[model samples]
Target: MANPDFEDLVETFEFLDDWEDRYRHVIDMGKAMPPLEEALKVPATKVDGCASQVWLVPKIADNVFTFRGESDAMIVRGLIAVLSALYNDQPVSDVMKIDAAAELGRLGLNDHLSAQRSNGLRAMVERIRETAAAAA
Candidate 1:
């Protein structure tokens, strides 16, 4: 099952008629996220394989998983927001069980994103899964 917040995002994507509008909505979602602390953007948090600079900081509390991330590019930042919705506040077990590729595909992102972006997204998902597995 997807996060309730992610389900809301899917609903919003469905409401938008055009890709341009949906793209803007994604950017708006990124704008709505709080900026990650500069100190937290260190090497350990940095996600490799992305064309733009990206960092993800994960936190697990009592078996619930959560993360915050940032990217140098706006679109990438928006992508991070989308990932946050997909994975945040989930139980560690549930986090590992999520099919991120399928969930993102529901938004038609797989068809629209560039190859580089797709790879980067995959990298982020891998990192999240690894973190969750470690916690579990």
Candidate 2:
């Protein structure tokens, strides 16, 4: 099941008629995200396989999974926001159960994103899953 926040995003995407409008919406979401502190941008949090610089800092409490992420590219940052909506505040076990590709597919991201961006998104999802799995 998708998070309510993510579902809301999906609804918004459905309302938008064109890819350009959806793209702008995603960029706006990225612009709204709080920037991660420079201190948290260390090698430990840096995600590999991304064309742009990216970092994800996990904050697990009482088995709940949450993370804050940042990226140099606007689209990538938006992607982080989407992932946050999809996975944050969920139980660690539930995080592992999420079908990320299917959820993201609802946004038609795969059809629009460049190959490199798609790979980077997958890398981000993998990193999230790995972090959740370790915590579980």
Candidate 3:
């Protein structure tokens, strides 16, 4: 999908004067994520190092990569939404060039994140990049 959702998220965060509002917005994004099929929720797709269970399935077609993910926790699911905005349906070249931590910093989410959340988020990024590398 051609997700323009990240631009909306950035604009919404800029409009909100407080981290509380941004956090709420993130949670809302999580609420918007499509439900993953139970059949795709296998151990191999699970993201390790996350406090909550996360499953990611990546697909490549016509030189573009797309992802589907889900998380048990709302905030983590929001983070996955952020990833979808950043990574989904992108060319492998674009995906390989991204600095996920830097992009997440643009969202201003990391400083407020708990240590575990931050670590899990980074783990997700690593997984994405690794998948991108293999696809490339």
Residue-level lDDT of model 3, residues 31-74, one tens digit each, is: 99898999999998999999999999989899898899999999
Q: Each model's C-alpha lDDT?
A: 0.94, 0.95, 0.87
Compose the digit string of candidate 2's lDDT tens values, residues 87-112.
Answer: 98899999989999999999999999
TM-score of model number 1: 0.98
**Per-residue lDDT of 33 in model 1:** 85
**Candidate 1 lDDT tens digits, 1-136:** 8999999999999999989999999998888889999999999999999989999999999999999999988888999999999999899999988999999998999988999999999999999999999989
TM-scores vs. true structure, each candidate: 0.98, 0.98, 0.93
Better of 1 and 3 by TM-score: 1
Q: Lowest lDDT 10-mer window, candidate 2?
A: 1-10
Better of 2 and 3 by TM-score: 2
Instruction: Tell me which residue pairs clash in candidate 2.
Output: none
Per-residue lDDT, model 2, residue 43, is 99
